[model samples]
Target: MKNLKESLKRRFSESNGGNEVRSPLRVLLRKEVAEHIRSWRFIILLTLIVLTFIASMYSSLSNIKSAFVATDNSSTSFFYLKLLTLTDDSIPAFHIFLSFLAPILGISLGFDAVNSENNNGSLIRLMAQPLYRDNLILAKFLAPLLIVAILFFSLTFLIVGYAMCISGIPIEWQEVVRILAFNGMTVLYVGFWLSIAVLLSIRFRQPATSALTAIGIWLFFTVFFQVVINIAIKAFIPDPNYLSADKIAYYNEVILNILRISPSQLYVDASTTLLMPMVRSLGPVSMEQMAGAIPSSISLRNSLMLVWPQLSGLIAFTLLLFAVSYALFMRREIRS
Candidate 1:
């Protein structure tokens, strides 16, 4: 391994000649991306996402005609956006399916990111090269992130094209913007999970341990967390029947604030607001607040404004995890 590293370093130095040396970061990033693309786990996850996309699109198309007819008399617009949010009862909409599957895709890509290299005894050898630890860790996160963005954008365009063919409606600029924004938010949401997985990978020595821990975290947020929240809410409220309106409102607010602590809830709120223009509020709206409001779809600006807090939260949490992972990975001793 030492000889191989020396030879590779020499080759790179010779190739660079007197010019600036090539960036090891770029080489590592490309290698990470290629490995992710060629991995069987990635292939399986990609196939699952594609299948779900197809199922959701099929369900959306089946209901889209009726949706159009039903909304014909209404002043609502952005029908093109419905291709993503609309679906039958049997299959969830694209965004809903994505929320569930995207996290798994992220976890699969990153749960073994660092630990697997360490287990295979390549990490110390890589560190022996010209690469900085910062570059290596950053490349690990960025490569999966880039691949995720590409996958999501491609799927979004595919949905758009399929919708256009079936609905015979050119997508409005507003609709295009909204769809793009949703895709971007989804990427961030997945990145949050990816960061968590990466952190676990760095923290645990075994890839299997990190992978299981990451999945356990996902399951906690996706399933058990909500249940615990509901139980806690019930324990607090006890009986809403006897509670005053003000008390009920207070508890409702508390519940929402608690739910927002979960990343999944944040993603859902942001995605829903972006994909559905009619969603004007993420929280409870008093009758007084809605009394004089016009019944109209909000503009793209308003939709973005509505989701900005959630989007910001997702960004903050993702960064926090990655930063923790980076700090830990950088400070740790690497031994062969």
Candidate 2:
């Protein structure tokens, strides 16, 4: 009897003493990222990105081949030359493709983030652990961001490899780095939507409602609001040329600032600035000898600076939305 009691006491003491305290942040991040990778949604998302990239490359390369083999025809050669040149600027082309697809992926990953956890009864159990409440929100936000980055870089590598093997064109270091940086910006731009979707997920307990809300917001930015803005601009500013150079510049700045309200638009404009050189008008000081003023294209540094306001806006909005979600999750009563 004494031995049994002593053994039981020793076991209890050892269990208490060996309660290894792992860093909640590290534990949550790893668990969340691993769970995301294991989910069918992540697999499907990655597969879609890979398959789409492959399809695009096949189609683009076929077009390039046809362009090179075209007969000595005026329209054929003209169009083919433009097409071939555009292919050389693949980074911009990739941006155009990602502009549409990235938001959908972002929304998909985040729309059900919180509600699904609640439905699965995981949220309550997760909270029961010695983890900070904020950890869950941070994990949810970061896992998708990491996935976005990984898929982007993977697609870039695949594209570069295919281009090299098929076209026999050497990859320039600058082109590779530029494309990589452009892809990174796109991931962050997509992260903004993910953050918004996560905020909605936390706000609504029903998964369907959260998903619908996210779609509605997506449509508003992509279609509805843009139409409204166009109409408003046309109606209010009937005479576009009445504005002077300084006024036009100021107006452009204002318009960009307003559009930054929607991350999608902000991203598109920032991308345009990044990918294309500015084609400035000659204006009154028009040099008769010169075709166009084309006031020196903005440097990459200037482009990055121009995007700063939008980037900062996105970061601020993401932080604010996340803060709200975290606060709500922490304060809510999770009844098991």
Candidate 3:
């Protein structure tokens, strides 16, 4: 702790004295990036996710080969993306595996962000510097986010490149665009988890408590949420078979809406839509609505339009969590 403070103090002093200058936020961000890169949590998370990507890609290649042999057609569309979406009996799709594990990256980076420093009393010392008060939290939050984004985006390129090599299929430009959007949405989904973890850090004084709280919430949504949803639905009707056709449709709609309340569900809905342009709709469709509908996969624009509300909900929730975090942090007294 002593050495860290001395180093930071010396760095800040030297920067101010030198002819070259940098913004405080940039300096803080760089420092944080270095710390995160060296942290054991970051290393473990990186290794875990990399191994997942490899396993997923291997499975996808095998599936694509089998699918190709089974079909007479040699021209397969969106072949590169199947690297992320296609799964064999052994391994699941790349995005499906990612959807389950990606939040851990955010959780690993942010679970200790504020409270750990406060517990060590270093946060107070860091704030004693000439930098604006908000800069600390702002830089802390953004640095991890930027680094996580780069990490995941790089992994995306690796999967796509490998899938290209194995499949020997040419990817369309539009498909490339859609995959890029998929990568971006994946990052955003992880960012939402990171934001709330930071908020929890503000609310809880113990790093362990904040971490456990975040993981608890995550588990509830990922593991038990749908179970609870199904239970609620069953409890309501007792016997879904007794419902009329119109009632069944309404019941399905209610279930879908409730499931979207979970971040995991929203990510799945949005990521699948983005990666698999063949997906036409995420919600209930009336007979009239589907009467004139084309059987083919929809365009990227159409897919985006269909999932815009889900995307918006994810973004809004992230911003709302960050806003609450900032408010709570700003209200906290350093003496406490």
Candidate 4:
């Protein structure tokens, strides 16, 4: 084993015209990132997101104008955050735009990541190089993730800048931290879908098949899953309106917990908690728990504490899907 390892290091070093050996993951990552940046799918998604940003900014500006004129002065000091979350007559808020579009971007970047390369005979050739199997699969998973991060972060900063310019309000430090954290959480959410899509890519040799599979799952969760869950809940727990408040609350809790199993629901819960500081709780809040609770926005730390389980769930799902993809890829034969 040691002899083979030394031979590979020597061979790879000599082949790359360097005395020291280096991991091929970086080389693969750079190549994949460049490809992703140049892909039409990425371009289309970015363009759509930018258009949403512009529309959102326009409507947000109008909304913020009205908000500032209101006499209540009830908005927390972090009013600037509202510029991105609030919607007006015509356009959705920035976060709303993201909740819908982020999955499509993830599927686009990952649905064909592996199979397209296989179709073009690139995978075998790339694998033919002096690289370990782990390096190939890990980089394939990460490069798209990094690309998604770039797209998300760029859009986030652009929205923030536009909000600042239009609102004319300097965002507070705590607000900036929350926004930055929200960006990271959004990245993780999208990256989870990316990993799932890539797993489909690895499982299906046909790029179109993998792409369709990913889109089908997205549609199921986005549109039909809630309806299905409602039907199931209704069938199991009939006449909830006739029940007492405690019973009704328990039924709703059961339904909500079941719904949270879907990735989209989890993403929405976490995003809402992070972006909307006024959201006191995601789960059932009994009257006792709500007693004496002022109707006010909480600090960033408290908000994170509320949503940490959600963030962790997203992370776990992403890692689990990636692990499956890695295992499948490692077991696959290039020659076959």
| Candidate 1 C-alpha error for residue 211, in Å | 1.1
Residue 257, model 4: lDDT of 89
Worst 10 residues of 4 by lDDT: 1-10
Per-residue CA lDDT of model 4 for 1-336, tens digit only, reads 234345555556666555333446666676677777787876887788788667876777688776565414675766756766777757667777888888887888889878988898877767766777888777777887787787778877887787678667677888888888888988888888889898999999898899899999999999999999988887888686689888888888888988999989988898888878889988788898989999888988999998888899999999999999999998998872
lDDT values for all models? 0.85, 0.68, 0.81, 0.80
Q: lDDT at 290 for candidate 1?
A: 84
TM-score against native, each model: 0.93, 0.76, 0.90, 0.90
Candidate with maximal TM-score: 1
Tens digits of per-residue lDDT, candidate 2, 1-336, equal 233334434544455443423245555666667778999988898888977687567556756655445423332222222221244443335566787888888899999988898899877767766556676788888888888898887876776676567756555443454466567778888887898899888889898898888889888988888678867777766475786766665555566556667878777766665554342221222235356544355555666777677677777877787788778877877778
Best by lDDT: 1
lDDT (C-alpha) at residue 61 in model 1 = 77
Candidate 1 per-residue lDDT over residues 252-335, each given as its tens digit: 888998999999999999999998888899988777788989877888888888898999999999999999999999899999
Q: After superposition, how far is residue 140 of candidate 3 from its true place, in Å?
A: 1.6
Tens-digit lDDT track for model 3 on 37-79?
Answer: 8988778888987898779767876787764553334343666
| Candidate 1 runs further than 4 Å off | 1-22
